[model samples]
Target: MSEKTGTFVVTHAESESAVVRDVETAQVHTLASNPGLEVHDVLEATVAPEPPLEVTWEVIDVGDRRSIELVDSDLEPTQHEKDLAADAEVGDLQQEERAGTGEIHVFCVPEDEVEAAATDVLEDEETVARAARLEAVRVEVRRAPDAGVLSVRYLPD
Candidate 1:
């Protein structure tokens, strides 16, 4: 079979085995060997199914790999983002893809829970990886208290 190449996020990794999820397709692959992979690592690689049973996959060629960064930005959300949040109901999340690369996510939350919600996003690995799918390396979390919103911007290096 032909090899598949794309961005993959390490969902789980250990000494013996590892699991990677394709960022574009959301397909999951189980690796027979860890190959020094670590959880939350994003890899740009070519993979092929193992011979015979084809029950597992192998990282045949690695092009690039990196760990995403999640940071709490002191910068406030942009005015447009604030307007988006103003239109959204509490507990709603709105996502917009950037014109070039990356994404902007505006989340409407309760005024009292803004800090906690921001912290939750910062700690969630899947959340970060989801944003990084747009070729982002850094995720900036900003709070707009007046709008009771949290703005998460996925940015390139």
Candidate 2:
């Protein structure tokens, strides 16, 4: 079976199952439901054919998840945060490795430059060489706050 990637809009969700509509093909799919999913949530999944034209999907990620929204809201800059933000020069980058996953978190990138920064980080020869040794999975760029804070998550294979 081949794999198909697309965004699915959740139509109905229950404890064990969910009905979703694919944005690209307009096909409806049913799969095991995930907790906290609700109607209208957009999920990114890779679907593979099962049998008899039936398909099963494994969710790769969720867009606009509530936890992310909550985090964004919580990261709003207060007076102290604004002061700290002002002190740091824009375009500064910081990297830290997660304890167990070996995932790398690159922080403090300006929101306006995240896309370019992510591309540079992923395409750098040094980063490429290191990732080749680590067998990394993928790099994700995220905007953490409305005030232009960005972070990159580098996941390992």
Candidate 3:
């Protein structure tokens, strides 16, 4: 069997994104915000840190798929930002709870990549990434106003 990727949420399977996980290479399919970028022959996941945005949290329940609360990463919002987000009928988002944010979030980023990165630190001492295959890996992502831990679940291809 070829490598495969399996996307997961709550207790459901997202078959379309599920494919075999290639140990040597991979293609990550993150959300529109975080495009699945490729790393060629990445012997290991190099620490490439990005600056964190000032965010507040809000959890929008997805019901079955999963309740996804979009956390507004912008905590210190400008006057314009606040005005735009405010709704007369709905409560002020900025003033609302952080767990009440985040909406229409795509299941971004492959999980295997995260695992490989965590494991790579130990695995690299023995083996080196000689080649990489452009395989899509099923991944689960969890986000919050406070950066939470995200994990990936690989499936057989």
Per-residue lDDT tens digits for candidate 1, residues 1-157, read: 6679998989899999999988878888999899999877889998899988888999999999887777898888999999999889999999998778888999999888988889999988667568647778888999977668999999886
lDDT (C-alpha, whole model) for all candidates: 0.87, 0.51, 0.23
Residue 16 deviation, candidate 2, in Å? Answer: 50
Candidate 3 colliding pairs, count? 36
The number of residue pairs in model 1 that clash at the backbone is 0
What CA root-mean-square deviation does each model show from the true structure?
2.7, 11.7, 21.0
Query: lDDT score of model 3?
Result: 0.23
What's model 2's lDDT at 121?
Answer: 57
CA lDDT, candidate 1, residue 146 = 62
User: Once superposed on the true structure, which residue ranges of model 3 sit more than 4 Å away at CA?
Assistant: 1-4, 9-74, 91-157
Give candidate 1's TM-score. 0.78
For model 1, give the 10-residue run with minimal summed lDDT: 125-134
Give the 10-residue window scoring lowest on summed lDDT in candidate 3. 125-134
Q: Candidate order by TM-score, highest to lowest?
A: 1, 2, 3
Please estimate how well model 1 matches the true structure, expressed as its whole-model Cα lDDT.
Answer: 0.87
